[model samples]
Target: MKNSFYLILIGCVLLACSTSKPEVVMVTKTIATKDTIRIANDSLDYEVIIIDAGFSSWLDSRAYPRKYHSLNYLESKNQLYVSEWNNRVLQPQLYNPNLYEMTINYDPMLRYGYEVNYLIYNYMIYFQNTNKQKLFGTVPTR
Candidate 1:
């Protein structure tokens, strides 16, 4: 089996304060290879990249199509997942540092559109199922 690659995208930090909204930091090492799963909003100039080698193929074969999950459902689940993921990132002692690498900055207030939310939501699901870890409760089944 091929080893899965993991890279921290360090997605946008959606700080509520007006003056300190940091832009998304793109990892220069990886660039946009076919294996990378990227979600970008040009207007906002914020982007997210999931650099898991297995994610691309898993998303295609295992995950349900975008239509299967509604925008609200995706956003809501992402809220839960991102919050827990960030928590795990903060406390590496408790959670595996390998599984929870970096903090994901996702703001419910800022609309990331359907595609962005869809990809992020599915990525979390893939992450949990593949890693045999749960960002929330149980490992979600497709």
Candidate 2:
């Protein structure tokens, strides 16, 4: 009787262990999209592809010397450069009053996409970094 009870207990333990829940796995899906812009000059038109969505903000954050320029000065300088780049590169009809306000329209249908914005955004950054001057002039450090 003792042996039979032990055998029964062992069988029950084995069954319980075998009946444990199965492991679960989860997967996420991602999709990639592409955008491009055409910039026209007097003699030629150029096509530019944009890949990074955060290019505009990133350009703003990195354009001027953080150690030298205050937050307000940095922002002002970025805006000045953007305005000049816009007049030089983008289609004139696409220029919007909202630009100087720093409230650009990113909708591909309405204005342009990440790429177009970044193209000009980076252009301004390059111009500022190389010239060490804003499009208009230098900002007062405080």
Candidate 3:
């Protein structure tokens, strides 16, 4: 009887020891590429190269539809938004004055295209994002 009790106790101890190991879990993180520009005690950062608020809106608008618009349609729509932003930049603006103040040279804004418009557009986006403020009137729903 004593030997049987010892055998059961040993079996129980072995079982407990066998099941006591902790599980190992592996986690993966995504690293995004961001671009940053610093000038004279000022810092600007952007996540994407493209920067038009209208283009951004159009980009978000495509998520639910999951369809691509024609190049003409996209260009025209984005151009409208870009022009609106350009006009706002020309006049006195209410939101995020630092963005305008820091880089408020409008002499080159005469030409309205991807390169010229997106430069200031990117600056506004970087300023807004860095400051963590939704100073812009429009917010993308998606």
Candidate 4:
């Protein structure tokens, strides 16, 4: 199962590489096996595919537990983080294009349930910490 997920991550990375759009930084290292986390809500038609090497472990160990924060708080934080992330995506010359690869189309009006918001909020925290990028509020530490 783990191997399969890594394969999927590799495939996604390869597909991204094949894009005609030029990247600011070209890094062509044969990706070693890495963790790929897929969070999906079928009824809501939302899916988050995180293809980072240590993300899964960090999430489990460092991220706040589910339900630790209110849904409203999570939603608000996600909105801020996603907006910042998208802005960074637009300004690759200023920010690392590799870190902000794609823009997140997160609708603030939509209620993606607690689980979705929780993961997103935590992922933003993880992303910020790993990249040394600070978002709106102080990131939670455990």
Top-scoring candidate (lDDT): 1
In terms of TM-score, which candidate is stronger, 2 or 4? Answer: 4
The positional error of residue 3 in candidate 4, measured at the CA in angstroms, is 18
lDDT of 1 by residue, 1-142 (tens): 1123334455343421123334443322223465886555555566566777777888878999868989889989989988998999899899988777667667776666677777778877887887788887887787
For residues 87-133, what per-residue lDDT tens digits would candidate 4 score against the true structure?
Answer: 98789999886666666666665555676567567767877787688
Model 2, range 12-119, lDDT digits (tens) per residue?
Answer: 223323322333121212122432222322111222332334433444565433344343444444456545644533453554322221222122222222333334
User: lDDT of candidate 3?
Assistant: 0.32
Return the TM-score for each candidate structure.
0.77, 0.26, 0.30, 0.70
Best by TM-score: 1
Ranked candidates (TM-score, high to low): 1, 4, 3, 2
RMSD of each: 5.7, 27.9, 26.6, 11.0
Clashes of each: 0, 0, 0, 0
TM-score of 4: 0.70
Give the candidates in order of lDDT, highest first: 1, 4, 2, 3
Positional deviation of 28 in candidate 3, in angstroms?
A: 31
With a 3 Å backbone cut-off (N, CA, C), the pairs that clash in candidate 2 are none
Q: Which ranges in model 2 have alpha carbons more than 4 Å from their true place? A: 1-46, 49-82, 85-110, 136-142
List model 3 lDDT by residue over 1-142, tens digit each.
2223223322322332232223322121212223221111011111112323343443333332322334344344444444454455455556443333221222221222233233324334443454454434663333
Give the true-structure RMSD of model 4.
11.0
User: C-alpha displacement of 12 in model 1, angstroms?
Assistant: 4.3
